[model samples]
Target: MNEPTLPTLHWTRRALLATGTAGALSLLLPPVAAAAPEEMDAAIREMFGNGTIREGRVSVKLPPIAENGNSVAIDISVESPMTEDNHVRRIGIFSPRNPIATIAEFHLGPAAGLAQVSTRVRLAGTQSLRVIAEMNDGSLWSGKASTYVTLAACVIG
Candidate 1:
């Protein structure tokens, strides 16, 4: 049996110093901040200008307690007919406590069959999740649900 030879390793002081400087710079940089209410409101208003967000018409389905914060199941359904005259235009998902409050935006057309969607998202912690549905007629509907996360993700202890 032949014995394997270990490869020789070379260390450069300049390379090590450059790597350490880059690491220190990263720590000094400002952390990514979460979306504020004003920003979120502006985004919503931009989507639905001068439109009121009424509840009841839209429904949000999520567990009261999330076992895993990495992948939380979410479902949103709007009470609307998938017709040429009346249909859902888009669906926006928001998490108040996430680094970016706006999680996802799904555009829908009449061919979608129904105004319903299901997906999984990462939650930073226990926070309120909001779903806004925009109709073809420029009407906005909203649904909200609170989720308690047992283990939060994307945050350092």
Candidate 2:
């Protein structure tokens, strides 16, 4: 007796079209919507416990226009001696238009030398990004920059 052959799956024009449509629809619906300005402010306030955020002291560097939104380079440098008496405690990066407003938080100590950090982040769209640095003396310093994304990575409503 001859053995039975297994059935083969084939892709038809109609099936391919349906699959493409479904994929496109999924892109339209993101996992989380972009956070509003007030939401971002509340997040920062909650983290720092309603402290005053002052400008200067902390330097934030980012290109005015990002060709790719998936990986935007960011550099943060705070004016600190990085000693027991005067050092940077932590640094928080926030993006207002991202699905999650809080991007990253870096903890520093005297061993970290100068108060500086470099990292890359994903931006959903063109928005204001904030960098907050807390010194050992319970003082908060922050910097803000407006970035434009030529190509958006995340879908924003």
The candidate maximizing TM-score is 2
Q: All models: lDDT?
A: 0.81, 0.84
TM-score of each: 0.74, 0.77
What TM value does model 1 have? Answer: 0.74
lDDT tens digits, residue span 1-157, model 2: 4543532333465678899999889779864557888878877877776778899898898899998888899989999889988899989998888888889999998999899899999988888799999888888999987789988767422
Backbone clashes in each candidate structure, one number apiece?
A: 0, 0
Q: 47-126, model 1: which lDDT tens digit per residue?
A: 66767788767899889999888889998999988899999999998877776668899999899888889999988888
In candidate 1, stretches whose alpha carbon ends up further than 4 angstroms from where it belongs are 1-38
Candidate 2: 10-residue stretch with minimal lDDT: 2-11
TM-score of 2: 0.77
**Model 2 segments more than 4 A misplaced:** 1-32
